[model samples]
Target chain A: MDLHAMDRYIKSLIKEAGHKIRNSFLSDISIESKSDANDLVTNIDKEIEQFFISRINRDFPGHRIFGEEGFGDRIEDQNGVIWLLDPIDGTMNFVHQKRNFAISLGIYEDGVGKLGYIYDVVNDDLYHGVQGGGAYYNDERLRPLGITTIEESILAMNATWAVPNRHFDHNGTLKLIQDVRGIRSYGSAALELAYLASGRIDAYISMRLSPWDIAGGMVIAREVGAIATNFRGEPGNLLEQDTFLVANPSIHSRILKDYIRQK
Target chain B: MDLHAMDRYIKSLIKEAGHKIRNSFLSDISIESKSDANDLVTNIDKEIEQFFISRINRDFPGHRIFGEEGFGDRIEDQNGVIWLLDPIDGTMNFVHQKRNFAISLGIYEDGVGKLGYIYDVVNDDLYHGVQGGGAYYNDERLRPLGITTIEESILAMNATWAVPNRHFDHNGTLKLIQDVRGIRSYGSAALELAYLASGRIDAYISMRLSPWDIAGGMVIAREVGAIATNFRGEPGNLLEQDTFLVANPSIHSRILKDYIRQK
Candidate 1:
């Protein structure tokens, strides 16, 4: 595969998708409830997903796709080349705030991530990484994350996870909140991970996230020395929804062992 | 007092201060801890405060200044025209993220909010309001908040407030977190309030915030029909630090009665 040519083509496609999203903000948005009232999907979300699927199929015939909007292929096994796409990551933010959402995409070969991209559509920030190459925030190269104690770190996660839930113990999550310097929730997992790679934040945690949500982020974060794992300190599942913790290598394990207690 | 003229003058001063803050990002920043390690103050913060103080003192000699850096007058009472200034709200974000911080300034006449301004320096978004005049986000007039129930609203607050704390019961806060559509924490009280005024967020809560921390936001929020009060449902203290709850008028009382339990 011509990785360089593919990277250039994918960047242009993501930018064009972003342009479509920006244009949608001017028109009326049709929204619907997904699993719950808070779990929302808009017309633009489905439209953007279809936009990517059509282009990818035309350019790469043999490659398969796994997408958030269910507009792509169903993979029974990790084989050949696969593109994971989340056309609109934070649909709630898109419907409520008209910002804080992004388009996330990742390319993997036989389950190995090779290229990743996350575009903040509203802010025009494109964070992308090539495996074995460095991560870049827009035109600037991202520096590898440095050591930082949990006491001095800023952690980002949804406030919902800290409430009483069956996924993990609320007490441990609350304790972690108190121990950290501060907490932030941007409502988008992909953008939070991009922030981690750019050193805007130290760590990001999510109780339940799908593969498309974290696949692109994992590739970018790993290039900058961030560790991605489930609560059990294992590589997160790339094919199933699971708990996710991506953080600077210095504090990842400490947070998992001392704070995250999964039920 | 001609509020119209004062509004115009204050707007210029805030823009100048914001310009200075953006310039500071290119230079070296010296950071120090205030009350604790997490409570940070940077040289740029002090510089910005002094910058505003010098201009206000020179232009409006009769007005008293209350600032976060203690570089202004020792305000004893709300008698004359007073300028409440935070110079740089979210100083930690300033030193760490290089964004999400703002210049918050509020002008009051005999304890009555007259004018307010919150400048998001990095984004160039200026939110302001005049007494009896509508609020604005940049050039667009902000619409008054419409009704929203607790279950369909988004709440913005620090996650630490949900942990065991002396100011309020953690259980009630946790319950509120579960009931809301979502929760957000942007690390800047002023920007968060600006967001509330613009309808980007439905409510904002803080356990301990000083007058400067919320003075500007209160003016803007109130102009948009949001209610501002302490946990006890009284007008928040304007001269001291206290718990704060600013929400859309529709759900403000319900939240206070059922979810906010002060201890």
Candidate 2:
């Protein structure tokens, strides 16, 4: 596959999707609950997902699509070329704040990530990476993440994860919160990972996230020397929901070993 | 005192200060630690404070200034007309993220908040309120905060406050975190308050915040029918640092009564 041509096509497609999202803000948005009240889905989300699916199918007839909105194929395996898409990553923020949400998309070939793109729609920042080509934030090239100690790092994660939950020991997460210089929660996993690539933040932790939520981010973060893994220090699952930790390479293992204790 | 005229003048001064802050992003900034390593102050912060001080001293000679950088008068009481200023709220974010920081300024007359301003420099969003008039985000008027339940609200606070600390029982905070739909930490008290006033967020809590950090936000929040008080249920102290809770009036008392236990 000509990855260069595909990269250019995806960038333009994401930008077009972002434009539609911006226009949605001026119109009435219909919202619905997904798994629960907190798990929301809006008309805009489904619309944007369908928009991408239609375009991708027309432009690249051979590429298989896996999407959060279920508008794409149901794949039993990560074979051939697959496009992972999260049309709107932070639906809660979209419904309430009308900001802090993004379009996260990633492309993989036989389970190997080749290109990633996360467009911060509100901020108009597009973060993309092409495997060995490195990452770029908008027009500027992002620098490789340098060494950072936990004591001097800013960690981003949902505050819910630090409270008592079924996923892990809350005490361990609480202790990690105190050990870091500061904590931030932007309500979007994709944006948090994009921020890590650009050095705006050092690490991100999530108790539960889907493949589409981290696919684009993982590709961009890897180019900046960041690491992505489950709590068990294994590669992130691209076909299932799981706990995730993406951080600067300097402190990823330390956080995983000392602070992540599964219940 | 003609508050109308003062409000107009202050608006222009804040915009000018915001312009200066935007310029500082292009120049080299010297950073230093205050109180602790995480507590940071930058050359741009001091410069911005001095710039506001000089202008205020020249324009309104009778008004006393209470600022974060200690460049203004030593305020002994909330008497006469006073200008409370935090030239750069969220100095750490200013140094690290170059965004999410704001210029917060509040004017009070005989202990009564009269006018408030919070300028999000990078985004060019100016939030202000005139006592008895109304609050505004830029040109649009902000509506009074409608009722919201704890289960359906978004709470903004420093995540550290939910960890074991000297200020209060961490358990109460943890319970509150679980009850809320979401929690956000933008690292700027002024911006958080501005967000609350605009209904972007429903509640805000801080274990320790000074007058300058909240002076402007209180004025704006009050106009939108939000309540601001210390953990003990008294008015927020203007003369010293104290625990603070500012929330939509509907859930303010509930959170204070059930979820804020002083250790």
Candidate 3:
């Protein structure tokens, strides 16, 4: 596949979808609850997801889409050229914050990530990566992840880690938090990944994320020499959802082996 | 006092300081260790603080200056017009993230906050508030915060809460985390406050923050009917360093009275 042509096409499509989202902002947003009361989905979310799905079906009929809104094919497996998309990664942030949310899309062929794209709609910052071409924020080439220890690294972990919860041993995560230089948690997983690719945050850890959540970020991060996998240091389950740790390659294994444990 | 004049002047000063920070990016940053091995102090931080101090003193010598760097006066009491300056509110973010940091400054007279400013130094976005006049983002005038409850509100919290650690009761904070619609932490107090003022995030909570940390944010937050206080639901100690919890007035008392407690 001509990766450059694919990248350009994806970027143009994401930009078009972003324009639709921006226009929807001026109109009234009728929000709805899904799965749970706290888990929300707005009309615009469904609209944008459908827009992308239809376009992809027309452009690349062979492409399989795994999207948040059930607008695409049922993707139970990571086979073929799968496009995992989160039209709006931080839905809460987008619905309320009106900024910081992003469009996240990752293309994986034969269960291996081939490319990733995360476009921060409002800022117009497009972070993209092809398997070997490396990541780019806009047109500038991104450098590989810098070497840094946990003591010197700034991490992006939500404050939820410091509090007790069910996913992981909250205590263990908090201990890791104190050990790091600092901590941050932006509501959007996609933008957080863009930041990690840009080396703004040395590492990112999140539990209970779907494949679409980390797909785009992981690809871009890998381009910058960052490593991403499940907590157990095994290959991330492309089909089953689970806890995740994406960090500087040097720190990934140690953090997984030393700190992370399943509850 | 001509608050309008003061506001204009301070805005210009902040923009100038922000410009200096922007230009610093073009050159090599000479960094040094401060309080700890990982803790950093950049020449740009010092230069910016010094620039604000010199400008304020030259025009208003009778006024006192309380800055992060020692360049500002040794402020004991808020007797006369005092400028509380944090040249870089999220210094760690500035040094490591190179983004998500801001220049925060708050002007108080006889212990009453008169004006507040938090400028996203990299993006050139400025949040400003005068006591009576409403808050603003760049040039857009802000409105008073609409009342919101815990369940409906989006919270900006450090991500460590889900894990266990010192400071607050991890479990209780978790309950607080679940009680909110969503949680976010940007790693910058000033930007968080600006978000609060802009009605992006409904509230903000931090374990331990100094005077300069929340001073500017408090002013802008106040203009939008957001309450600025400590965890005790009382007037926050302006002179003494303390933890910060600034939120919409409707919910500030509830969080302080029910959740946050002294260790």
> Chain A alone, TM-score for each of the models?
0.98, 0.98, 0.96
What fraction of the native interface does candidate 2 get right in terms of contacts? 0.65
Regions of candidate 3 where Cα sits further than 4 Å from its true position = B160-168
C-alpha RMSD over true interface residues, model 2: 0.9
Q: Encode model 1's per-residue lDDT on B50-121: one tens digit a residue.
A: 988898889889989999999999988999899999989999788779999999999998999999999999
Q: lDDT value for candidate 2?
A: 0.92
lDDT of every model, 2 decimals: 0.91, 0.92, 0.85
Which tens-of-lDDT digit does each residue in B92-156 have in candidate 3?
Answer: 88877788899999999998889999999878788888888888898799988988899989888
Point out the worst 10-residue segment of candidate 3 chain B by lDDT: B159-168
Please tell me how candidate 3 rates in CAPRI terms.
medium
Model 2 residue runs over 4 Å out of place are: none
Tens-digit lDDT track of model 2 for A1-263: 88889888888989999999999988999989998878989999999999999998998898999999998999889899999999999888888798999999999999999999999998899999999999999968899998889998999988887778776898998899999988999899999999899998899999899999999999999998999999999999889999899999999999999999997
Cα lDDT for residue A147, candidate 3: 86
- Cα lDDT, model 2, residue B238: 80
Write one digit per residue (lDDT tens) for candidate 2, span B1-263. Answer: 79889888888888888898898878899999999989999888898899999998998899899999999999989989999999999987888788989999999989999999999999999999999999999969999999899998999987887788776888999999988988999999999999999998999999999999999999999999999999999998788899899999999999999999997
lDDT of 3 by residue, A131-201 (tens): 98889999799999878888888788766555556767766776787788878888888888899889888
Winner on TM-score (1 vs 2): 1
